[model samples]
Target: MLNIALFGPPGAGKGTQSKMLIEKYNLAYISTGDILRGEIAEGTELGLQAKDIIKRGGLVPDEIIVQIMEERIQTDTEVNGFLFDGFPRTTVQAYILEGLLLKMNTKLDCMLSLEVPTDQLRNRLLDRAKKENRSDDTEEVISVRLKEYDTKTAPVANFYKEKEIYHGIDGLGGIDQIFERLTSVVDQTLQKSWINLVLLGPPGSGKGTQGRKLAEQFNLEYISTGHLMRQEIKKDTEMGQSAKTYMEKGDIVPDEIAIRLIERQIRKHPDANGFIFKGFPRTIVQAYILDGLLRKLGSVVTSSINLDVSTLESIKRLTYRGKTEGKRLYDDTDIIIHRLEQFEKRSIKVSNYYSKQDKFEIVNGLGSEEDVFKRLTDVVNKSFKKIR
Candidate 1:
């Protein structure tokens, strides 16, 4: 997902540029002032706290603002990305936002700062005050606002600057010209941001364990096909119903259905740095289809890892797991052997497809879990190094 924080002082034309970028990029506008007003209007708990603070002529605390911002983000899950305006007013808030986004498996792609001369900003605000006849936009009020931005907001630039995601757009040009600069920077930032990985291995090869670990380490969304299908079925979505019909008849869900579900999950997290795909593309045809799907999204598989474990070792692990865990359905010795045999028959072809693209690796999955995880991380780090 493409997430940006728009930074500028008053009268730097942030509102004007924000409108154009929102339409062009399909981003959800997340303005802190709008959220606060909505909360107050709805009389929610946070709203009451904010209202009380306003009644006492006090600035709302940053922690409260962050709490409300997270609530908004959690509730509004359908979007290509987010445009953050007027929230991170301090260096502390910038760090908080980074942690918050990391927790959500996404990261702010950039902070587009509109840089304008003091005289120009003052002149623009004065002209705006005259045109709109806004009493609050008086010279004195604008001065205070600009001072607050300088003292409290301007330092946010340094925070993003250190992260190398800060871009400064000259706020002195024509509206269209400034917008072109913003989009150019945005396009370049997006090109270098995504990290898609697919995990391929047999049932007892620790795909789930390693996939989850890598996703958290790198801030990527983890897509487990079995879990995704179960979630859809629980929600009774149309796609889920269709898959259910096939599954009830002891049939494999068609590749079209699986691909559609995977695409839906991918689009749900437009702000995600990338995805860790587990258990989806089981066939050579499915691998081809997955590649096409990611291509449509302007991404490709960064790496496809096969966790190499012997058949006897896999049997031993599954048997021990069956006695201790008892959660997986395919843990029976006979079913485990059958599943491994089928995977060996079909998934090797899928692995070869990725290998031909020079994006395939085999990590030894023997020994202790920690040892295996180290081997997996080595391959992953190498893949992501090339991506970055």
Candidate 2:
């Protein structure tokens, strides 16, 4: 599949529409703005110069921008076609981008331009400005901004049109309409895009049930770590023996050994974001090690959801699940009581571990799975709130 270049104005909802297209179709979002910033940080000669100009809230020079673009596209793995959200506003940048793609033997598949009316743009910008409390957004600045965009960007639209690679979608419709059109165009253009997102939850807390629902809804791969552990115990590998040692003694496996076991499983499924760590990392020490392992692999838990189920409620759910499953992992009442005691003592200090670092959520895990899910969804939405 070829990479996509999404072109649209400031208030045209390019980000909102692009997110729908990406999630629905599985697209890698490649923003030149992100590349430009990263380039400057590496002090790659060109980045050093752009750093000064951009630090003052001014635009970087065109050559430096294109140079940054050239480096980024060459290195990116196309797990899905890229959606270029903020890029190629000028014809020169577009021309330079074509050369870079040609050198890599890749071509931009489609250029999607969001078309919104001038009046709507004005209202949207003003309302956003007021809500955001931006001092620079006056009627005068907004008017000038629109005019400058027209002068600089209209040429790039015409250029893509001449190449017959541009598709225009209405940006003023109801969100669903805009999103539906965006998805249709992207599916028609690319061969691959979606990815598996797994959520790890403990017994009776609803990870398995809700994860299945989310996977089916998004068409993603689903794998449970607890299931994996059970399978390994069934087979009895070296690490499995290590885990079995603790389980047989009614003790949680220590972090150092448990992490290596988790790492082996992780190496097998590199494409999936990660194994949903349902029961691992129950302590601050484990979370610390997991952080290093994830960093080495170049990703992090997209979010860590703490289902804040009351001690009594958690015990009830766990007890019922253990009895029904009859698996050793769930079958121990003494262990469950011990774990909950550990949870309460560490509650205060645990927040400091995640408060400033991890994408953590403390969802009220007090009620039914359905009730907890409503809250879980809210945390998921907030954590990825910017995805749309």
Candidate 3:
């Protein structure tokens, strides 16, 4: 579901744009103020309780508002998604809403904040009061409300921003122009929600072929550690020189050096829909470091696809490629066996780490390219469905 939170101070035209969004997206609208007023008009029990609080010049409690929202969400069942309006007024309420949505097996896809000047907001509210005859919208009341928003409600935007799902929309334009901006943000968020994956395999297990296919098919960035390392060496950066020294000695590059290179590449694509990590995180330590990096970005490795191929099959394939392409690394059978042994030792621990998180899947690599590609895509699509 494409759940969204519409955020703005008073008189930012959220009500106008929300109606257009509902028409375009078939979203279920949930405005706490609207619901409370309806309940009061019907003289329901909760409404009476709220009215009594108002009569005593007190605000309704947060618990009451949460309960009302929970009830509303449970009863609504015929919408494509939800547009939250005039709810989650505080940071605490924002966290509460997250828990509620999680229990329902959904989450907010994005939070759209409308940015408008304070003077414009005030003028708009005064004009609205004249048209709607709302005594409560006086200039004094609007000032207090805006002040309260700055103090309490603005933090809610920060909460979503930390999750990388907050989008600030310019709320100063014609209605259609503003709507177009809001829709573009939503579209980008949906695109970025695709699951990022890592592909793990030994030498000659077809990781390159399948990774490229999956990235192209799903519109994800394809990241290869070997490719990145070679690029770094060509650039002759400090870390690249360190890696080159190890390569000159016929030694594997240290995990720290490889991870730094990969991290740099990952940072370059901050707005990618997702990434296919090819030939990376080959050891348990690298896997942990990768997790930390993703957490800092408000993301996680959706799954790790391990391609399983026999040692003999890998050696044969590499030997054939070496003869055809004149590559020395793959020409020696003894070196190929040693590399396979090293891979088995480190990869088992890495696989166990992801297995505990239920994010590991193994596919047979001794097959036609089409067959292997199909298996890889199946796991990816399944992971996407679980997260959604």
Candidate 4:
């Protein structure tokens, strides 16, 4: 997900620009002042605390602010990204935000600084005062506010600049023109964050279960070849018709057909942070096809993780599932064993393929769902760090 910290002087049109960015990019707008005032208005415990502090002419401590920010972030789970405005006003707060995002298994993608001349800012604020009759927009008040912004907020830009994710945009000209400039920088930054992953394992290894969780945790598109083929067949499309012919004959679909299905899924999510390919590339040929497709897309497989479940465990899980679910025809003992053998043969070859590229990982899948997920996430986190 895209996480942006927007920086600007008082009259650099941050409010207008952030709203446009939110609408265009599906980002959740987060302004610290709005969050704090919302807390006070709600009369919750944190609100009461913040109210009392404000009443006593005291600044809320960083810990309290962090708590509020964390709570706000947790409550919003469906956003594409977060647009942080009027936050991290100090260098210390910038570090705090960094730690907070890292704790959430993500990081700030960039800081977009809107640059406006001081005279232009004064004229804009004065024009706004005339239009809205805002008493706070007086000459002296605007000077103090701008000076305070320079003192407190300017250094935070340096913090991001050091990391090389800072993009300075000219906050002049028409609103649409300015937005175009912002989008140009934002689009490039988001592209860098896109990553593709492959999840490999035999049946009953929980790769499908874990793949869904990974997709949610990392804001990725989850693509399972089996699921994609089923969807295609359900839709009765051309590829579906061809796939149906092979399935009716109990034959595997051609690699080209499977590759087309994978390609279709990838194209469906042009703006996704990445994809988790679950149970695709079942053969070495398919693996090469996938690599070629990704190369065409200007991305590479970040990792091919095998969820290593023991043979006994895989058999037991399949047996239990067959008895309990009574729907998996292939879960019959003989068929299950045959399938596992085939999977083992293919998995080892594909694992070796990725190993040669230094992008293979083995995660222990014999544990509680949460435990296995934690191991998977650990591997994913390490891979993401290497990419960034």
Winner by TM-score between candidate 2 and candidate 1: 1
- Candidate 3 per-residue C-alpha lDDT over 1-388 given as tens digits, one digit per residue, 9 for 90 to 100: 5688998888899999999887677688999898888778899888888889988999988877887888888777666568998668888888888877755545778889899999999999999999999988889999998888778876887888888788889999999999999999877766666467989988889898889999999888898877777677879888778777655443568988777777787788777888898877888888878776765665667789999998889888887877786454334666677778778888899898888656789999978999998888888887775444
Superposed Cα deviation of residue 272, candidate 1 (Å): 18
Q: lDDT tens digits, residues 156-235, model 1? A: 88888887888988888899999999999988886676788999988788888888988998889999886777667779
Q: Which residue pairs in candidate 1 have backbone atoms (N, alpha carbon, C) closer than 3 angstroms, thus clashing?
A: 1-270, 1-271, 1-272
After superposition, which runs of candidate 3 have C-alpha atoms over 4 Å from their true positions? 1-154, 161-188, 232-241, 245-251, 267-271, 326-331
lDDT of each: 0.82, 0.66, 0.81, 0.83
Report the alpha-carbon TM-score of model 2 versus the true structure.
0.46
Badly placed stretches (over 4 Å) of model 4 are: 198-200, 203-388
Ten contiguous residues with the weakest lDDT in model 4: 325-334
- Higher-scoring candidate on TM-score, 2 or 3: 3
The root-mean-square deviation over C-alpha atoms between each candidate and the true structure, in angstroms, is: 17.0, 13.1, 8.0, 14.6
- Select the stronger candidate by TM-score from 1 and 4: 4
Candidate 2: misplaced stretches above 4 Å?
A: 41-44, 54-59, 190-388
Global lDDT for candidate 2? 0.66
Q: What digit string (tens of lDDT, one per residue) describes model 4 on residues 1-388?
A: 5788888998899999999998887788888889999999998898889889989999998888998998988776666668999888888899899878755545787899999999999999999999999987789999998889888876888888888888999999999999999999987885576688999988889988899999999999999877777678889989888877765443457888888888888888888888999878888988888877876675567788999998889999888988784434356687778778778777778999888656789999987999999999999997775544
The candidate 2 region of ten consecutive residues with least summed lDDT is: 191-200
Top lDDT model: 4
